[model samples]
Target chain A: MMRITRDSLLSGNANRRSWMALVNPSASELTQAAATLDIPESFLRKRLEGEASRPLIKQERLISLQFQVPMPKKGGTGQFMLVPLSLYFVPGYFVTLSEQEIPFLSQLIDPQKPRKRWELVLRIIAEVTRNYLPTARSVAREMAVVERDLRQAQRHDVVYRGLDINDRLLTLDLGLLQLEYVVSEIGHFLPAEDAVLAEIHEDTRIELSQVRDQVDSDQATINELLESYAYVVHNNVNHLFKFMAALIILATIPLFIPGAVAMNVPLGNFPHWHYGFTVVTGGLVLVEMLTAWVFYRKGWLRLD
Target chain B: MGCQFYDTVEDVWVATERYTADGLFLLMPEQVHQCPQLEAALQRCLEQRLYCQDAEITLRLPVALLAQDAQFGTVGRMTHLTLHHTPRSLAILGEEPLIRRLQQNWLGELRHTSMGELLQRVLLSIIYSHERVARVLVERLQVLRMALKTAMGNTELRQIVALNRDLGELVIALRETGLILRNALRATPGESPVYPLLDAALREQRRIEDGVNLIHERYLAVTNAYNGIVQNNAHTVMKVMTVWLALLMMPIAFIMPWHMMTPLPLEHWHYLWFGLLAYVFGVTLLFARWARKHGFFSM
Candidate 1:
């Protein structure tokens, strides 16, 4: 859908200007917008088709920029979808083209809050970068939940969740890197003497830098959490193995004693006295206790 | 100058400066004042040594230098070695054994390696040594995990915590040293031959970090599992005790009332003793069956 609104209409024609926003635009809509804005239809077509074969920013009579914004995806996996946003800027007109509805663009749709074309673009960029912070925070929270689950029980489900969070955080990092590059490139195209453009450039630079730093910090945290999760799982397996080993030791003692008696060995006066049965029974019990005590003392059994 | 020269090819420290080939100079902490040129070089790279001031192996150059503490083995104390590397010469100030070992191990490479490559080697050697320590920690952790399988006690827990702490400290040291080297490399102007070596050192640093992190994760998981096992064992013990208590109470409750009676109802009866015995045996059998059925003996 294509929504074109004039800022002058809502502001009593004080400063007449128009901006176009395209949400999931078709080829025909892109062509129309391209014709109205005096831009090459191919530029809009390439962007609308989601072709990102060029650098983030391209300069000519009209300036075109392509950058990605973080979008949350639905599923058990806490993954973020990177949606590419294409912007075309001329003297007094600005246009934004996206494959899906840009959630933050609604703020600019209200014609009552009129903004200059560059100012609007800067705000859009800032909003796109800010979008990552919330996603990062949510991912961090999800990681913490997974960590808690891991502590309670080393289950595969928690591990899968942890891996999913790692994947999402990696995606966020990649997207932020591309965004930083784009923002830095935009600074080169701004007029050197324009104070407002310079100020906007500086603000965008600082904002993007902050976002990148935050993403890096989040990535480091996720990495550590994932490591801990793996460790918890390993420790649990080791515990099970240890338990089984102790069980084997316990089972071996009884088996060895009976096997020895069945071999017809004359040890302990076996088969030589009327009270042999009683003696053997008592001896078996005694030996079992001794073995258990020994194992316990050697740290092989968890009797306590 | 009255000095001893250790030859890489010969693998021996001779008490003569006759075979003075351009290579690393090993300097002791005390000998730093003896050689004015070496002393100046140490002052130049003094700031760089701050990060690794307490590290066993540190890279500061007029030539590659290592300061070995004579009291402890090379691995025992952080060898406070000052190593310097210059294009014309390599000077080291450390213990005789350490220098001799280095000479023997890198005999062929030391003879042929350029000064920059030698510097890189020194840095790489430091990183590799730390990496070895990390690997040992990892192996120890594996052993600890195996020990944990059979039982976990306070000692086992302490060992795990200790290993984790050591690995953590190693990771931090490697990172700081790596950063220092990288920054130092960047600060150097023009094209220096040490970039590749520094770059390799950086890579090794990262590898050590990764290895340490893996060990830490495994330790954490194993520790948690060990605690769970302990708890489960405790629970089982409690259940068994409860079952035993219940069983013991039944016989006591049956026998205590007989003793307090003024006259037993069938005391003169011929089968009275047999009946009481049968009754006690039947109740014991029933209670044992019930306890088993309720999962008291499941462990």
Candidate 2:
């Protein structure tokens, strides 16, 4: 049997209301809980079993929101991922189902602190949004490292790291965008159900916007960095091609004049003279040198 | 199954079985029942309920890097190592090079230290050396990056290829070895100072992995750039040779035929034609031979 604790997690400061936390329940347990609550089992089960959906409310009296909270990958590898925290609102009370432990939930929803449903959610969202900062800020830090790597001694490794940061920021960017939509929807659905929640939600909104702004800026910077590096690679290849083209032109010009004159124009008696071959070959070389000098002075062959 | 007994009192490796069970030992994989001590440690571990005999949990790792089994069976092919501590003695097994490396780097003097302290040193020695190798590889890649700024020779190009292969292998080995180490280390208590050391080692391993991956990325760009350089240089030289050769031959083509048809400059025109014909034939044959040798055409 699923134990239902009706003790008020929010009381005195919040209205005289209660919420239940379902910590890792089975299908039968869920059904049992739904039977006790007199709510449809399928509504709760859809959230429990279905993959994470955007935070939204169903119109059939029961309001539900699936908020994803960032949880660290176990063993503390300095990496984290978003896991769902499902909340079901039925009239005056709410029930939560979580896939991961909320370490700060007990402290955040303390009876001493006192909170209404919307106030509780505002605090929860604020806390969960705060969890995103470490990973989000780590991206900014990694971005700086990458920028430094790119600027300094060519960090062949940062190229790989830059790609990782690019991917990480892109993922965070998508998650935050979805969350922004969800946060706004929650505000719309619940409205200022609690004056305290509205007041607290303002604080959460500022923090959210700050994180969102950082993510957006990081995403843009990563895109620009990747593009600039691509352009660098392209420019290197193009520079080589230009050098080759110039060398070909240099060779071609010197070769062409002799080729055109070799059409057996009158050599006069030059072929009969002892110095004939020398004079003609020397004259051709002199013309070639002059062509080379002119091309060199023109700076068409130079590259940065 | 290379086994070396470290006589703790003497502070040196010895072949004799004279050392007590309290002495330290260096060991590799056993040949079934070769070392009763391993069997004892294994049984003691099983008795201690250190970890379930078969329970396995997947540690989320970057799938692109490794997809290795984490069940903690000695895994480095022939070079995998494990440290075993019996009631009376300690031993490290697997990876002959690592075993040899450990033996070479052994701290001299007393061996009356606690098992935990000795084990800490042994594990640190392994990880520290591993991290050093990664650092050296990174330096070599740095040198290569600088070299790539200029034109590359066959030697430098070959070095990059070698570095690419080495870094790729290191990346795989580091992760696999890291996984094995984690699985092995977790068998011990969480509060052991070794746990913090393992964490540090893990952090270093990640840094090294990131560095290796970045260096490996460079391989593709450098290879492409260098290949372009070689091809472009070859193409330019070939173009110049072909253009000049064709041009130089233009006068010969016209002069040889025209002068032969009607030339009143000298007698012995037959000798001139005969010698010139021989020369032209030799040049044609030589050019054909040169082209064929250079793979422009078959002989």
Candidate 3:
């Protein structure tokens, strides 16, 4: 893929260089492309290696930055990863090289209306920053879903719904933090002279700010969901415990009455009847049912 | 090489780990023959009969693996066999290759499933809790998008459209995250197959989708109630305006001077203007207060 870089630009000439359509280049192609543009080989190579490329030294005439972008894959959880590339721009021409095709840039720099070098670069960054909005929105959406699950988890007999919501919120929180970091980098690139790029940069900054706000809003909602779930579970457990305690108290009430009758000193002279135990047992059963009915009507024992 | 095995008798999931192994060992339980998906795969394998007559049963592996086999040449050696006794874990492992292949083949499918599941859960949660009305409103935006197509029109429709685009973009991000998760899942091994967990995950996703639909219904119901209230308010406003206009005409009638010719007082005109203005002002203040309390002005 790097094979097409310098030669492709040279053969087409500077005026006719149709660099718009060149995306999805291989690692070697990116290396070759970087070579053609007089870019440092390591700069381009580092970008493609992984999503978490640490901030490092500036290669001459080029500044490489790596940031995470959320990707949703099937049978997989969402993740933020670095997209590698080296960018080398002079007054006349500019070049970008990446192992995998970045669709956002490709859309912006179409053949019919090719963007200027600086604008292209800034727009690429701007678009990437804009991505935070959608990412935040997605997180918010997922969080909402998680929240819903937590609420209804009990209905489905799944007490683990809270865990799911917690997990989803955690993931979103991490993504939002990474998004903030990426947006802050755009601020570093804002220059006084390039007012246009500066404006674009500012717009992106606001977008990042909005994303943060959304994330904060989402965090609050998650917290509330957790609290509400906790309260419900706690209240339910408390009610059940109270009912159990009530049952014990009610059962002991009749036992106390029998003890009182049997231990009475004045009644010790009377002879025991054959049906006494049966009568006492029946009376206890009836009293227990009556007590249960009264408690149930008073809303002490909830079926749920 | 380090090899370890643990049995989870309580959960019916077995876990085994082996280092320095090049191939996977599949020990299908007798119960596997009962599963339709497994049965089909088994039947295909038996029909192909790739192995010589040494064994009575043969299992058909995926064609991509067959191509791989063709490239590498026949089953040469038993590199690894880390036995696991848990059915749940085994089932999950069985589905691993399928999940991986699906993830690779259709990123959109993966993204949609994950996103769709999430949206569903959010909606379900809001359905039970009256306190989360605002979130329910916000979440409805996604359901509306799924209901409507790409080019939904009008103000409400446009908002929904914008929301849908937002969801699509969000799904893309989630898809990226999903890829990372896939990698993590691949890296992590367990006593049980990951497939049962995945199955449950998918089920949970479906449950969430169901919840979203319910939320959508609830949202529409709430919107309908608002629309009805607006309509009733419009009717009330028309009635009030008509009454005011008729009352104003009474001043015109009074000015005709049928009874006013006897003693036309300047105080009457001042009182009339002041009263009319005060009444209008009072009505305006009341309207403003009502709108403010209901959050109409904020919108």
TM-score of every candidate relative to the true structure: 0.48, 0.38, 0.40
- Which runs of model 1 end up more than 4 angstroms from their true locations? A8-15, A74-78, A152-160, A191-197, A224-228, A265-269, A272-275, A293-299, A302-304, B1-299
Per-residue lDDT tens digits of candidate 2, residues A1-304?
2334454455324445556677778888888778766787876776767432325655556777776677767664335677777877765456778766678777776655556666677778888788878877766676675555443222133444555565566556555655565566567645545576666767888888888788767656665565454444345334434544554554454344444434566756544665544454456567657766775677644544
Residue pairs whose backbone atoms clash in candidate 2: A157-B214, B79-B95
Off by over 4 Å in 3: A1-34, A51-59, A75-101, A143-195, A223-228, A248-278, B1-299
Instruction: Write one digit per residue (lDDT tens) for candidate 3, span B1-299.
Output: 11122222331212344211212223333334444533454444345422112211121221111112332222111111112212221221223443343223322222223322322222222121221222333455535433322222344454443433333332332333233324323433544243334333333323323333333333332332222222333433443443344334333322222121122234357476676556555654664475345322221
Q: What is the TM-score of chain A alone in each candidate?
A: 0.82, 0.65, 0.66
Model 2 interface CAPRI class: incorrect
Point out where model 2 deviates above 4 Å: A1-5, A11-17, A50-54, A58-60, A74-78, A91-93, A148-163, A188-195, A232-304, B1-299
Per-model lDDT: 0.59, 0.55, 0.40
For candidate 3, lDDT tens digit of each residue in A1-304? 4322222232112353435222456666666665565655555554555422323223345544444444444453333343444454422334555545566755775656654444565566566656655655654565555545443231211223433433344444444444444445546554557677677767766776676577557655655554455444334334534544554455455544444445536653232444444555456567768888888898775524
DockQ computed for model 1 against the true two-chain complex using alpha carbons: 0.02
Q: lDDT by residue for model 2 over B1-299, one digit each (tens)?
A: 34577666676777643224466676545431466635555444434323222221112122111112244211122133455644345565545566676677654443676555565566555544443454455466556544544433565566656655655666676666567557655764577545554554454455445444544443343444444443333443454455346434533542332242122233457686666666666765675565344333210
Better of 1 and 3 by lDDT: 1
User: Which docking category, incorrect, acceptable, medium or high, applies to candidate 3?
Assistant: incorrect
The lowest-lDDT stretch of 10 consecutive residues in candidate 2 chain B is B57-66
Comparison by lDDT, 2 against 3, better one: 2
